[model samples]
Target: MAQLLAEKRDFDFVMWEQFNNEKFLENEKYEAFNKKTCDMILTEARKIAIKEMLPTMAEGDKVGLKFEDGVVTTPECFKPVFDLLKEGEWGNLGVPEVMGGQGAPSFVASAVSEYFMAGRSALSSYVSMGSGAAAMIQLYGTEEQKKKYVKRMVSAEWGGTMLLTEPNAGSDVGALETSAVKNPDGTYSITGNKIFITCGEHDLCSNIIHPVLARIEGAPAGTKGISIFIVPKYFVNDDGSLGDRNDIWCTGIEHKHGIVASATCSMAMGAKGTCIGYLLGNENEGMKIMFNMMNGARMHTGLQGLAYASGAYQLALNYARERVQMRELGQPHDAPPVTIIKHPDVRRNLLWMKSYVNGMRSFYQYMDYQEELSKIADTEEERALADGIFELLTPIIKSYLANRGYEVCVQAVQVFGGAGYTKDYLAEQYMRDCKIASIYEGTCGIQAMDLLGRKMGMQGGKVFMTFLAAIQNTIDEAKGLTELADLGERTQKMLNKLGEVAAHLGKNAMSPQYKTAFAHSLPYLDVMGDTIMAWMNLWRAVTATQKLAAKPKGKDLPFYEGQIKTAEFFIRTVVPTSMGRMDTILDMCSAAIDISDEAFGGL
Candidate 1:
């Protein structure tokens, strides 16, 4: 099997052709970068992924993590890979140079992360949490906080974790019981037990910084009263050196189904009443401050979905091309057995994986571009639109991409038959690892609610309408192209149905029949995801059509035409079924709401 993380040609096409990443060069923020420089950086990232990081995948999975006496140790083989990520500065790809980073654009950083994550998501978790912690400090922490933590986290001299989920508080963060008491020195003495803390306690770094969510004494009872605190494993001196250990300990690590090398810990703070935690933001503003990090984490989780799916698809593709099983459906019984790639059903599954993988890539890149636009838009209106659309799509991008990415992983396993189910192959591991992406961060159901309940009505629905109009515009563009006209019509019809369903559900959600409407939220989200994918594929096809029309002399004819074909397959084969789901949502049947508790009988 070819060691694949991502297809470079596809990456180039998306960056140079579809997205025009060159546009960033026009902005002063990116004045130091150009096409060659960006490409070279990506090339180096790829080398690091394939050569250095890839070797740790199986070792980490097989050896997993060891928890003993409150310390978590990852696979011995991973120690070198962890160091490589820090020394090569892969963890600081998007941070500003002033903060000791490479200052890459979001899209470029996303691309690099896809490769690194595809290499070893478990190890990548340590880097991700550290970088996320640094970003939060950079955005909201006081100057002293930034000076103390940001550079160290970005430099990977220390790692970090977001300690929000407690034993009693997972999805309902408002129900947390952790308490923070103010001490004489103006710092808080944090006391709490947080569960599901990824990289909570690891030997890879000398120190770990925790952004803990706890209720300050006399604060309100719910999420409104929560505050964020930065509690480091080792206290820092006034002159920037390590001091005595803080009152935090890792009780134990979970033996997870996969990504086992990443320590998922149960952490206890202030066990000895000495956990010195400095306030991250103002009291009672923790959720607001945490959003700055949660939003980014959601996006990165979406990328994990894409990365794992890509990993499975890559391995499956290689296996299919080499593993012969039976003759083609139409071939003679006496004929030689062909590779599974020649089988019709195998081909169908491959195309399914390819289409969704392609859509996910485009979706993530577009989201990253929007994030950049929110920062660098030429006008206030442009910035507002970028921010609104980004807010609207974050849930869908996170949940929808994860759902489909996992589906792709399942299909990859199917492509490999028995081998895919066995430990000899990585497909099962991919499935196991990707499963958490949908569950944590926010479950698909939670995301669906966010999409329908909040995003749909955002800014009196201007964002929703604007997004729909853009899809319509693309549909109109593709409708004029002779070869793509049919797929364009299919996509347009899905858009109209989706628009209607969104209005129906959004309106009903406010009425007395909210449960009935909410019951269908996940289904509605699926329909929206399908429509968005149709939009992405159709847009890609339109780009390919126009490019082929202008540059007919290119040797890359097949690749361009494949784009059109992929769009065609998705429109004809995928979008139609999603439209049926739209019909189901429009029906608004009350069976789920009306059914008695006993109907969901004994397990």
Candidate 2:
């Protein structure tokens, strides 16, 4: 089971060496965390994850969730683990101390999260969704609202979720029909039904607070009139004690293909005309507030990709090392069959998995570092740079990592062959659970549109240009090193071509042929994702080259060398395909849009 989680040495390399954890500790915002303390935190989290949580992963998936009337019963094994997480306060690791959380740095919290999430994503969502809600309340809630909800939410005493999707408004929030009417007091009465609400009605917490999106009576139409309200499962009194039950009820839970332990609910609010809710930010600003939380929520969604993919790759690697079935290509026919790891094809697959897993981990940590910098930077300029880059990378990290991460999981299944498809192994589960990452938190299509439509045009393209420039810096530094010169040159060429592609896409998106540009937006995002992966691999190579100069001995030698080799494998093996993909994009073929629907034979 331990072998199924992230490689600790690689995790340390990204945290301590690649991104430099020490620099984050220099900021007073993170003064409470030193390397030792962070290590202890990670160690404790790993223990809880491996020993207490990992055992429940398959058990939870098999047992799934139970719905009796309006109540949801999670997997029997999840209760103890959930209790342990809440008791240890692991859920609030990244929240600030002032806000009743442990105040760990973003990087450390992310490492801790990788362990827990890899152990069991469904169980972790309970806390994560609540923390997300608490963060919103902390940022936008009135003092009374914060006083009523934040601390309890931080402790997971009460659960939290965002209720936006209705039967009519899956992706389009403006079309939602949930309504709110002003009450005698400042509170409003909420009436609506919501679908796909995660952790919406679980038995884990005493109460569930919902940040529901509803338009007030007499408000204007469309999203401009939408307002957000804090509606709890059970009302809270003036003293913060649980009060009468609210009008919200869980109608049903979805039987999903994966993450079965999580209760994706059909929630009906104000059936009795008594659902009392307090306004969150202000009237007619719900979408704006929700968009603010979307980045974090989307990043959280992105983590699912890394979690499932890492665990799947680890499982595949372990299986290869143990499963003996193949002989080397040149070995005698009568010779002993070696472990699958000795097979060249299997080795290539493992390296393919290794390279992506390694790159994804580094890229995730890099994004976390940007978040830390944005918060801790002294100068406004530094903060802006961090903010700009973080925003620009958001869609890429969310969409690319998710889509690639799913592919990695699929590849892991392929590596395991027939055994992978059975319930006996967790590879299939990883693939199943990971499929949702690309579909949820807005689909990959939505992410592609956001990247091309909004993010590309941010600050008149300065943010996008800055991101490319940052990647170029790594390429330039790697070019100076003899060991990495060729790898860096190839990556630099890809980066240059990517810039041109971006320019072409940007122009087409604004031109009369916008439909053609939108048709290929997803492919454009794919190449961008590939380019970012290459950049991450090159960065790892530079770090490994610098470390090799120190003459590390024993296991460290292979580990450092592996980083360079992984970079070479990706740049040499995979990036040429990305270059070809870029060519197809430049061709700007309109077959997708030009084809008439009636011309298809399927009908």
| Top TM-score model | 2
RMSD (CA, Å), candidate 2 to true, equals: 1.1
lDDT of 2 by residue, 1-603 (tens): 337588778878999998887987987777788999988888888888889988899999999988998999988898888898999899999988867998998888888888888899889999788888898899999998999999999889899999999999987889999999998888999988999999999999999999999999989988999999999999898999899898999999999999889889999988866888899998999998887778888888888899889999999999988888957789999888988989889999999988889888899999998998898888998899899889888988888889889999999998888999998898999899999999888999989998899989888998898889999999999999998999999998999999999999999999998999999899999999898899999999999999999999998999999999999999999999999999998999998888999886689
How accurate locally is residue 171 in candidate 2, as Cα lDDT from 0 to 100? Answer: 73
What is the lDDT, from 0 to 100, of the residue 486 in candidate 1? 88
The number of the candidate with the highest lDDT is 2
Cα lDDT tens digits, model 1, 90-187, are 89989888777878899889999999988888889888788888888888889999998888899888998999998788889999999999988899
Clashes of 1: 0
Give the runs in model 2 whose Cα sits over 4 Å from its true position.
none
Off by over 4 Å in 1: 1-3, 551-555
For each candidate, how many residue pairs have backbone atoms clashing (under 3 Å)? 0, 0
The C-alpha RMSD of each candidate to the native structure, in angstroms, is 1.3, 1.1
Note the Cα lDDT for every prediction shown: 0.88, 0.90
- Flag clash pairs in model 1: none
